[model samples]
Target chain A: SQKIEQNSEALNIQEGKTATLTCNYTNYSPAYLQWYRQDPGRGPVFLLLIRENEKEKRKERLKVTFDTTLKQSLFHITASQPADSATYLCALDILMDTGRRALTFGSGTRLQVQP
Target chain B: EPEVTQTPSHQVTQMGQEVILRCVPISNHLYFYWYRQILGQKVEFLVSFYNNEISEKSEIFDDQFSVERPDGSNFTLKIRSTKLEDSAMYFCASRYSPQSSYNEQFFGPGTRLTVL
Candidate 1:
Protein backbone atom coordinates (compact mmCIF):
# COMPACT_ATOMS: atom_id res chain seq x y z
CA SER A 1 0.00 0.00 0.00
CA GLN A 2 1.12 3.59 -0.65
CA LYS A 3 0.90 6.45 1.81
CA ILE A 4 1.41 10.23 1.51
CA GLU A 5 1.74 12.74 4.27
CA GLN A 6 1.71 16.53 4.13
CA ASN A 7 3.70 18.68 6.52
CA SER A 8 0.95 20.40 8.46
CA GLU A 9 -2.77 20.78 8.75
CA ALA A 10 -2.59 24.56 8.55
CA LEU A 11 -0.01 27.25 7.94
CA ASN A 12 -0.30 30.96 8.51
CA ILE A 13 2.03 33.42 6.83
CA GLN A 14 2.18 37.18 6.37
CA GLU A 15 1.49 38.58 2.96
CA GLY A 16 4.51 39.22 0.71
CA LYS A 17 6.29 36.27 2.30
CA THR A 18 7.04 32.91 0.79
CA ALA A 19 5.07 29.78 1.69
CA THR A 20 6.57 26.36 1.47
CA LEU A 21 4.63 23.11 1.89
CA THR A 22 5.94 19.60 2.07
CA CYS A 23 4.68 16.25 0.84
CA ASN A 24 6.35 12.98 1.79
CA TYR A 25 5.39 9.53 0.62
CA THR A 26 6.42 5.98 1.42
CA ASN A 27 6.02 2.43 0.08
CA TYR A 28 5.72 3.49 -3.53
CA SER A 29 7.72 5.27 -6.17
CA PRO A 30 5.55 7.37 -8.42
CA ALA A 31 6.46 8.43 -11.92
CA TYR A 32 5.01 11.87 -11.49
CA LEU A 33 3.70 14.14 -8.72
CA GLN A 34 1.20 16.99 -9.03
CA TRP A 35 0.02 19.92 -6.95
CA TYR A 36 -3.50 21.34 -6.82
CA ARG A 37 -5.26 24.27 -5.19
CA GLN A 38 -8.70 23.64 -3.71
CA ASP A 39 -10.93 26.35 -2.40
CA PRO A 40 -13.69 25.75 0.06
CA GLY A 41 -16.78 24.07 -1.42
CA ARG A 42 -15.01 23.59 -4.74
CA GLY A 43 -13.08 20.94 -6.60
CA PRO A 44 -9.32 21.02 -6.86
CA VAL A 45 -7.59 22.95 -9.65
CA PHE A 46 -4.37 21.61 -11.06
CA LEU A 47 -1.27 23.72 -10.46
CA LEU A 48 2.05 22.09 -11.30
CA LEU A 49 3.43 18.64 -11.94
CA ILE A 50 7.02 17.38 -11.65
CA ARG A 51 8.21 14.12 -13.08
CA GLU A 52 10.58 11.76 -11.31
CA ASN A 53 13.38 12.40 -13.78
CA GLU A 54 13.02 16.15 -13.31
CA LYS A 55 14.43 17.98 -10.32
CA GLU A 56 12.35 21.15 -10.53
CA LYS A 57 9.50 22.78 -12.44
CA ARG A 58 8.15 26.30 -12.23
CA LYS A 59 5.14 28.23 -13.45
CA GLU A 60 4.94 31.95 -12.76
CA ARG A 61 4.96 32.45 -8.98
CA LEU A 62 4.80 28.74 -8.17
CA LYS A 63 7.62 26.21 -8.13
CA VAL A 64 7.79 22.48 -7.42
CA THR A 65 10.74 20.26 -6.64
CA PHE A 66 10.88 16.47 -6.76
CA ASP A 67 13.54 14.49 -4.87
CA THR A 68 12.98 10.88 -5.83
CA THR A 69 15.78 9.70 -3.58
CA LEU A 70 13.97 11.14 -0.56
CA LYS A 71 10.48 10.37 -1.75
CA GLN A 72 9.52 13.97 -1.10
CA SER A 73 8.27 17.00 -3.05
CA LEU A 74 8.08 20.61 -1.99
CA PHE A 75 5.63 23.24 -3.23
CA HIS A 76 6.46 26.89 -2.94
CA ILE A 77 4.47 30.06 -3.54
CA THR A 78 6.38 33.32 -3.35
CA ALA A 79 4.88 36.71 -2.59
CA SER A 80 1.79 35.13 -1.13
CA GLN A 81 -1.45 37.05 -0.90
CA PRO A 82 -4.66 36.62 1.08
CA ALA A 83 -6.31 35.47 -2.11
CA ASP A 84 -3.78 32.65 -2.20
CA SER A 85 -5.31 31.12 0.90
CA ALA A 86 -6.53 27.63 0.09
CA THR A 87 -5.85 24.00 0.75
CA TYR A 88 -2.94 22.62 -1.24
CA LEU A 89 -3.07 18.95 -2.17
CA CYS A 90 -0.34 16.72 -3.52
CA ALA A 91 -1.16 13.76 -5.73
CA LEU A 92 0.90 11.01 -7.28
CA ASP A 93 0.20 9.00 -10.39
CA ILE A 94 0.59 5.29 -9.70
CA LEU A 95 0.76 2.74 -12.49
CA MET A 96 -0.06 -0.69 -11.27
CA ASP A 97 1.26 -3.97 -12.53
CA THR A 98 -2.21 -4.67 -13.93
CA GLY A 99 -1.79 -1.74 -16.33
CA ARG A 100 -4.11 0.44 -14.28
CA ARG A 101 -3.28 4.03 -13.49
CA ALA A 102 -4.80 6.05 -10.66
CA LEU A 103 -4.06 9.27 -8.84
CA THR A 104 -3.72 9.11 -5.07
CA PHE A 105 -4.04 12.30 -3.06
CA GLY A 106 -2.59 13.34 0.25
CA SER A 107 -4.52 14.88 3.16
CA GLY A 108 -3.45 18.37 2.07
CA THR A 109 -2.19 21.45 3.92
CA ARG A 110 -4.28 24.55 4.36
CA LEU A 111 -2.39 27.80 3.84
CA GLN A 112 -3.57 31.19 5.00
CA VAL A 113 -1.83 34.32 3.78
CA GLN A 114 -2.74 37.27 5.94
CA PRO A 115 -2.08 40.91 5.28
CA GLU B 1 -11.37 26.39 -22.05
CA PRO B 2 -13.45 23.19 -21.70
CA GLU B 3 -14.33 21.79 -18.29
CA VAL B 4 -16.14 18.84 -16.73
CA THR B 5 -19.62 19.48 -15.34
CA GLN B 6 -21.75 17.64 -12.79
CA THR B 7 -25.42 18.04 -11.92
CA PRO B 8 -27.32 18.32 -8.63
CA SER B 9 -24.69 20.34 -6.77
CA HIS B 10 -26.20 19.02 -3.56
CA GLN B 11 -28.28 15.91 -2.91
CA VAL B 12 -29.95 14.66 0.28
CA THR B 13 -31.27 11.12 0.42
CA GLN B 14 -32.47 8.61 2.96
CA MET B 15 -30.24 5.81 4.13
CA GLY B 16 -31.98 3.14 2.15
CA GLN B 17 -32.80 5.18 -0.91
CA GLU B 18 -30.96 5.20 -4.19
CA VAL B 19 -29.20 8.21 -5.75
CA ILE B 20 -27.82 8.85 -9.19
CA LEU B 21 -25.10 11.47 -9.75
CA ARG B 22 -24.67 12.73 -13.27
CA CYS B 23 -21.66 14.15 -15.07
CA VAL B 24 -20.79 15.42 -18.52
CA PRO B 25 -17.11 15.14 -19.15
CA ILE B 26 -15.07 17.20 -21.59
CA SER B 27 -16.26 16.20 -25.05
CA ASN B 28 -12.95 14.88 -26.31
CA HIS B 29 -11.72 13.12 -23.17
CA LEU B 30 -11.46 9.33 -23.30
CA TYR B 31 -10.66 8.48 -19.69
CA PHE B 32 -13.33 9.10 -17.02
CA TYR B 33 -12.96 8.77 -13.25
CA TRP B 34 -15.08 8.95 -10.11
CA TYR B 35 -13.79 10.14 -6.75
CA ARG B 36 -15.30 11.04 -3.39
CA GLN B 37 -14.18 13.25 -0.55
CA ILE B 38 -15.64 13.03 2.90
CA LEU B 39 -15.83 16.36 4.67
CA GLY B 40 -12.36 17.42 5.83
CA GLN B 41 -10.72 14.35 4.31
CA LYS B 42 -8.61 13.67 1.27
CA VAL B 43 -10.21 12.80 -2.03
CA GLU B 44 -10.42 9.07 -2.66
CA PHE B 45 -10.58 7.46 -6.07
CA LEU B 46 -13.56 5.21 -6.65
CA VAL B 47 -13.47 4.01 -10.19
CA SER B 48 -12.07 4.66 -13.66
CA PHE B 49 -13.87 4.05 -16.94
CA TYR B 50 -12.32 3.79 -20.37
CA ASN B 51 -13.38 2.38 -23.71
CA ASN B 52 -16.97 2.22 -22.43
CA GLU B 53 -15.98 -0.24 -19.72
CA ILE B 54 -14.45 -0.24 -16.25
CA SER B 55 -10.68 -0.16 -16.35
CA GLU B 56 -10.01 -0.01 -12.60
CA LYS B 57 -11.74 0.54 -9.30
CA SER B 58 -10.79 0.96 -5.68
CA GLU B 59 -12.00 -1.19 -2.79
CA ILE B 60 -14.41 1.57 -1.82
CA PHE B 61 -16.29 1.04 -5.09
CA ASP B 62 -17.98 -2.09 -3.92
CA ASP B 63 -21.11 -3.86 -5.14
CA GLN B 64 -23.25 -0.90 -4.16
CA PHE B 65 -21.75 1.39 -6.80
CA SER B 66 -22.05 1.27 -10.57
CA VAL B 67 -20.98 3.57 -13.40
CA GLU B 68 -22.30 3.89 -16.91
CA ARG B 69 -21.69 5.90 -20.05
CA PRO B 70 -25.20 5.35 -21.32
CA ASP B 71 -24.96 8.11 -23.92
CA GLY B 72 -22.34 9.90 -25.93
CA SER B 73 -21.95 12.85 -23.55
CA ASN B 74 -23.20 11.57 -20.21
CA PHE B 75 -21.40 9.64 -17.50
CA THR B 76 -23.22 8.61 -14.35
CA LEU B 77 -22.69 6.98 -10.98
CA LYS B 78 -25.46 5.15 -9.18
CA ILE B 79 -25.49 4.12 -5.54
CA ARG B 80 -27.94 1.38 -4.66
CA SER B 81 -29.34 1.48 -1.14
CA THR B 82 -27.05 4.15 0.16
CA LYS B 83 -25.74 4.01 3.68
CA LEU B 84 -24.94 6.77 6.13
CA GLU B 85 -21.27 6.31 5.38
CA ASP B 86 -21.98 7.22 1.78
CA SER B 87 -22.27 10.88 2.69
CA ALA B 88 -19.53 12.65 0.79
CA MET B 89 -18.88 14.98 -2.11
CA TYR B 90 -18.68 12.93 -5.29
CA PHE B 91 -16.47 14.33 -8.05
CA CYS B 92 -16.31 13.36 -11.71
CA ALA B 93 -13.12 13.80 -13.68
CA SER B 94 -11.93 13.20 -17.22
CA ARG B 95 -8.79 13.50 -19.27
CA TYR B 96 -7.26 12.87 -22.67
CA SER B 97 -5.36 9.73 -23.59
CA PRO B 98 -2.29 8.92 -21.46
CA GLN B 99 -0.09 9.47 -24.44
CA SER B 100 -1.02 13.12 -24.61
CA SER B 101 1.08 15.78 -22.92
CA TYR B 102 -2.09 17.17 -21.32
CA ASN B 103 -2.88 14.09 -19.31
CA GLU B 104 -4.00 15.98 -16.26
CA GLN B 105 -7.51 14.99 -15.19
CA PHE B 106 -9.99 17.83 -15.09
CA PHE B 107 -12.41 17.59 -12.18
CA GLY B 108 -16.02 18.73 -12.06
CA PRO B 109 -17.55 20.93 -9.39
CA GLY B 110 -18.66 17.84 -7.47
CA THR B 111 -22.05 16.70 -6.17
CA ARG B 112 -22.38 16.80 -2.40
CA LEU B 113 -24.25 13.65 -1.30
CA THR B 114 -25.69 13.59 2.18
CA VAL B 115 -27.35 10.38 3.38
CA LEU B 116 -29.39 10.63 6.50
Candidate 2:
Protein backbone atom coordinates (compact mmCIF):
# COMPACT_ATOMS: atom_id res chain seq x y z
CA SER A 1 0.00 0.00 0.00
CA GLN A 2 1.11 3.56 -0.68
CA LYS A 3 0.80 6.49 1.68
CA ILE A 4 0.88 10.18 0.74
CA GLU A 5 1.41 12.68 3.50
CA GLN A 6 1.33 16.48 3.52
CA ASN A 7 1.39 19.02 6.31
CA SER A 8 -2.10 18.60 7.71
CA GLU A 9 -1.92 21.84 9.68
CA ALA A 10 -2.71 25.12 7.99
CA LEU A 11 0.40 26.98 6.94
CA ASN A 12 0.20 30.61 8.09
CA ILE A 13 2.65 33.17 6.81
CA GLN A 14 2.89 36.87 6.11
CA GLU A 15 1.96 37.89 2.63
CA GLY A 16 4.89 38.27 0.17
CA LYS A 17 6.86 35.52 1.86
CA THR A 18 7.59 32.25 0.16
CA ALA A 19 5.42 29.28 1.12
CA THR A 20 6.90 25.84 0.72
CA LEU A 21 4.66 22.76 1.01
CA THR A 22 5.99 19.23 1.15
CA CYS A 23 4.44 15.98 -0.08
CA ASN A 24 5.97 12.64 0.81
CA TYR A 25 4.92 9.20 -0.26
CA THR A 26 5.82 5.66 0.75
CA ASN A 27 5.60 2.13 -0.71
CA TYR A 28 4.86 3.26 -4.26
CA SER A 29 6.72 4.09 -7.39
CA PRO A 30 5.03 6.96 -9.17
CA ALA A 31 5.39 7.66 -12.86
CA TYR A 32 4.79 11.40 -12.52
CA LEU A 33 3.98 14.02 -9.92
CA GLN A 34 1.51 16.93 -10.02
CA TRP A 35 0.40 19.87 -7.90
CA TYR A 36 -3.06 21.40 -7.67
CA ARG A 37 -4.67 24.46 -6.04
CA GLN A 38 -8.09 24.08 -4.48
CA ASP A 39 -10.13 26.89 -3.05
CA PRO A 40 -12.97 26.25 -0.67
CA GLY A 41 -16.17 25.18 -2.46
CA ARG A 42 -14.32 24.89 -5.76
CA GLY A 43 -12.66 22.17 -7.74
CA PRO A 44 -8.89 21.89 -7.76
CA VAL A 45 -7.15 23.72 -10.58
CA PHE A 46 -4.11 22.11 -12.14
CA LEU A 47 -0.97 24.02 -11.24
CA LEU A 48 2.03 22.05 -12.48
CA LEU A 49 3.18 18.59 -13.49
CA ILE A 50 6.69 17.16 -13.28
CA ARG A 51 7.80 13.82 -14.59
CA GLU A 52 10.30 11.50 -12.92
CA ASN A 53 12.90 12.39 -15.52
CA GLU A 54 12.54 16.09 -14.79
CA LYS A 55 13.89 17.46 -11.55
CA GLU A 56 11.82 20.65 -11.49
CA LYS A 57 9.17 22.54 -13.41
CA ARG A 58 7.91 26.14 -13.23
CA LYS A 59 5.10 28.26 -14.49
CA GLU A 60 4.96 31.95 -13.63
CA ARG A 61 5.43 32.21 -9.84
CA LEU A 62 4.65 28.56 -9.11
CA LYS A 63 7.24 25.81 -9.14
CA VAL A 64 7.25 22.04 -8.47
CA THR A 65 10.09 19.61 -7.89
CA PHE A 66 10.08 15.82 -7.98
CA ASP A 67 12.75 13.58 -6.53
CA THR A 68 11.82 9.96 -7.09
CA THR A 69 14.87 8.81 -5.19
CA LEU A 70 13.39 10.45 -2.14
CA LYS A 71 9.78 9.62 -3.02
CA GLN A 72 8.91 13.26 -2.38
CA SER A 73 7.68 16.32 -4.22
CA LEU A 74 7.71 19.89 -3.02
CA PHE A 75 5.49 22.72 -4.23
CA HIS A 76 6.73 26.29 -3.79
CA ILE A 77 4.80 29.52 -4.10
CA THR A 78 7.20 32.44 -4.19
CA ALA A 79 6.10 36.01 -3.59
CA SER A 80 2.98 34.60 -2.02
CA GLN A 81 -0.06 36.82 -1.68
CA PRO A 82 -3.33 36.82 0.18
CA ALA A 83 -4.99 35.57 -2.95
CA ASP A 84 -2.68 32.59 -2.84
CA SER A 85 -4.34 31.38 0.33
CA ALA A 86 -5.85 28.01 -0.47
CA THR A 87 -5.36 24.28 0.02
CA TYR A 88 -2.61 22.83 -2.12
CA LEU A 89 -2.63 19.17 -3.11
CA CYS A 90 0.19 17.06 -4.47
CA ALA A 91 -0.80 14.05 -6.57
CA LEU A 92 1.29 11.24 -7.99
CA ASP A 93 0.55 9.03 -10.92
CA ILE A 94 0.04 5.68 -9.12
CA LEU A 95 0.62 3.01 -11.67
CA MET A 96 -0.96 -0.34 -10.99
CA ASP A 97 1.05 -3.53 -11.18
CA THR A 98 0.28 -3.75 -14.89
CA GLY A 99 2.09 -0.44 -15.27
CA ARG A 100 -0.31 1.02 -17.84
CA ARG A 101 -2.77 2.73 -15.50
CA ALA A 102 -2.55 5.64 -13.08
CA LEU A 103 -4.61 7.67 -10.61
CA THR A 104 -4.22 11.17 -9.13
CA PHE A 105 -4.47 12.08 -5.47
CA GLY A 106 -2.97 13.76 -2.37
CA SER A 107 -4.25 14.54 1.11
CA GLY A 108 -3.60 18.27 0.52
CA THR A 109 -2.01 20.94 2.71
CA ARG A 110 -3.96 24.00 3.83
CA LEU A 111 -2.27 27.35 3.29
CA GLN A 112 -3.31 30.70 4.76
CA VAL A 113 -1.49 33.85 3.74
CA GLN A 114 -2.08 36.57 6.30
CA PRO A 115 -1.97 40.21 5.32
CA GLU B 1 -10.96 29.25 -22.23
CA PRO B 2 -13.29 26.27 -22.13
CA GLU B 3 -13.98 24.53 -18.82
CA VAL B 4 -15.80 21.51 -17.49
CA THR B 5 -19.28 22.27 -16.18
CA GLN B 6 -21.51 20.41 -13.73
CA THR B 7 -25.15 20.98 -13.00
CA PRO B 8 -27.19 21.06 -9.77
CA SER B 9 -24.40 22.75 -7.83
CA HIS B 10 -25.97 21.23 -4.75
CA GLN B 11 -28.14 18.12 -4.37
CA VAL B 12 -29.73 16.68 -1.27
CA THR B 13 -31.40 13.31 -1.52
CA GLN B 14 -32.93 10.88 0.87
CA MET B 15 -31.12 7.64 1.61
CA GLY B 16 -31.84 4.80 -0.87
CA GLN B 17 -32.96 7.29 -3.48
CA GLU B 18 -31.41 7.57 -6.91
CA VAL B 19 -29.46 10.64 -7.96
CA ILE B 20 -27.82 11.54 -11.21
CA LEU B 21 -24.95 14.01 -11.34
CA ARG B 22 -24.37 15.66 -14.64
CA CYS B 23 -21.29 17.12 -16.30
CA VAL B 24 -20.40 18.57 -19.66
CA PRO B 25 -16.72 18.23 -20.25
CA ILE B 26 -14.69 20.47 -22.53
CA SER B 27 -15.84 19.81 -26.10
CA ASN B 28 -12.54 18.70 -27.53
CA HIS B 29 -11.40 16.73 -24.51
CA LEU B 30 -11.35 12.95 -24.80
CA TYR B 31 -10.69 11.70 -21.28
CA PHE B 32 -13.30 12.24 -18.57
CA TYR B 33 -13.12 11.37 -14.87
CA TRP B 34 -15.08 11.61 -11.64
CA TYR B 35 -13.68 12.18 -8.16
CA ARG B 36 -15.21 12.80 -4.76
CA GLN B 37 -14.12 14.49 -1.56
CA ILE B 38 -15.81 13.81 1.72
CA LEU B 39 -15.66 16.65 4.20
CA GLY B 40 -12.27 16.60 5.95
CA GLN B 41 -10.99 13.82 3.70
CA LYS B 42 -8.70 13.63 0.72
CA VAL B 43 -10.05 13.90 -2.80
CA GLU B 44 -10.46 10.35 -4.07
CA PHE B 45 -10.75 9.09 -7.60
CA LEU B 46 -13.97 7.37 -8.62
CA VAL B 47 -13.65 6.44 -12.24
CA SER B 48 -12.06 7.35 -15.56
CA PHE B 49 -13.85 7.16 -18.92
CA TYR B 50 -12.19 7.24 -22.29
CA ASN B 51 -13.37 6.52 -25.82
CA ASN B 52 -16.86 5.79 -24.58
CA GLU B 53 -15.81 3.12 -22.08
CA ILE B 54 -14.46 2.87 -18.59
CA SER B 55 -10.69 2.84 -18.60
CA GLU B 56 -10.18 2.52 -14.88
CA LYS B 57 -12.18 2.65 -11.69
CA SER B 58 -11.32 2.68 -8.02
CA GLU B 59 -12.40 0.15 -5.43
CA ILE B 60 -14.70 2.73 -3.92
CA PHE B 61 -16.78 2.61 -7.09
CA ASP B 62 -19.07 -0.24 -6.27
CA ASP B 63 -22.06 -1.81 -7.97
CA GLN B 64 -24.23 1.04 -6.73
CA PHE B 65 -22.49 3.41 -9.10
CA SER B 66 -22.79 3.72 -12.86
CA VAL B 67 -21.71 6.23 -15.51
CA GLU B 68 -23.16 7.19 -18.84
CA ARG B 69 -22.55 9.47 -21.75
CA PRO B 70 -26.22 9.51 -22.69
CA ASP B 71 -25.62 12.06 -25.41
CA GLY B 72 -22.72 13.74 -27.12
CA SER B 73 -22.66 16.58 -24.62
CA ASN B 74 -23.49 15.09 -21.25
CA PHE B 75 -21.55 12.70 -19.01
CA THR B 76 -23.49 11.44 -16.03
CA LEU B 77 -22.92 9.45 -12.83
CA LYS B 78 -25.93 7.71 -11.39
CA ILE B 79 -26.16 6.27 -7.94
CA ARG B 80 -28.87 3.65 -7.70
CA SER B 81 -29.17 3.79 -3.94
CA THR B 82 -27.54 6.72 -2.31
CA LYS B 83 -26.12 6.03 1.11
CA LEU B 84 -25.39 8.56 3.83
CA GLU B 85 -21.70 7.83 3.42
CA ASP B 86 -21.97 8.91 -0.21
CA SER B 87 -22.43 12.51 0.76
CA ALA B 88 -19.53 14.45 -0.68
CA MET B 89 -18.46 16.97 -3.30
CA TYR B 90 -18.29 15.30 -6.72
CA PHE B 91 -15.90 16.83 -9.22
CA CYS B 92 -16.03 16.26 -12.98
CA ALA B 93 -12.84 16.58 -14.99
CA SER B 94 -11.66 16.02 -18.55
CA ARG B 95 -8.37 15.88 -20.38
CA TYR B 96 -7.49 16.31 -24.02
CA SER B 97 -5.26 13.24 -24.18
CA PRO B 98 -3.49 10.79 -21.91
CA GLN B 99 -1.00 9.21 -24.24
CA SER B 100 2.35 10.40 -22.94
CA SER B 101 1.78 14.02 -23.89
CA TYR B 102 0.72 17.17 -22.07
CA ASN B 103 -2.18 15.45 -20.39
CA GLU B 104 -3.84 17.74 -17.90
CA GLN B 105 -7.39 17.37 -16.69
CA PHE B 106 -9.65 20.40 -16.33
CA PHE B 107 -12.03 20.20 -13.39
CA GLY B 108 -15.53 21.55 -12.82
CA PRO B 109 -16.81 23.38 -9.77
CA GLY B 110 -18.42 20.12 -8.55
CA THR B 111 -21.84 19.11 -7.32
CA ARG B 112 -22.24 18.67 -3.62
CA LEU B 113 -24.35 15.59 -2.94
CA THR B 114 -25.86 15.31 0.52
CA VAL B 115 -27.48 11.98 1.26
CA LEU B 116 -29.60 12.09 4.35
Best by DockQ: 1
lDDT of 2 by residue, A10-30 (tens): 899899999999999999887
**Candidate 1 error regions (>4 Å):** B98-102
Q: Score the docking of each candidate (DockQ).
A: 0.86, 0.73
Per-residue lDDT of model 1, residues B1-116, tens digit only: 99999999999999999999999999999999999999999999999999999999998999999999999999999999999999999999998875646457899999999999
**Which lDDT tens digits does candidate 1 get at residues A1-115?**
6799999899999999999999999987888899999999899898998888999999999999999999999999999999999999999998866687789999999999999
Q: Considering only chain A, what is the TM-score of each predicted structure?
A: 0.97, 0.93
Error of 2 at B10 (Å): 0.6
Worst lDDT run of 10 residues, candidate 1 chain A, spans A93-102
Clashes of each: 0, 0
Q: Is the docking of candidate 1 incorrect, acceptable, medium or high quality?
A: high
Q: In model 2, which residue pairs have backbone atoms overlapping below 3 Å?
A: none
DockQ of 1: 0.86
Q: Could you tell me how far off, in angstroms, the CA of residue A62 lies in candidate 1 after the best superposition?
A: 0.3
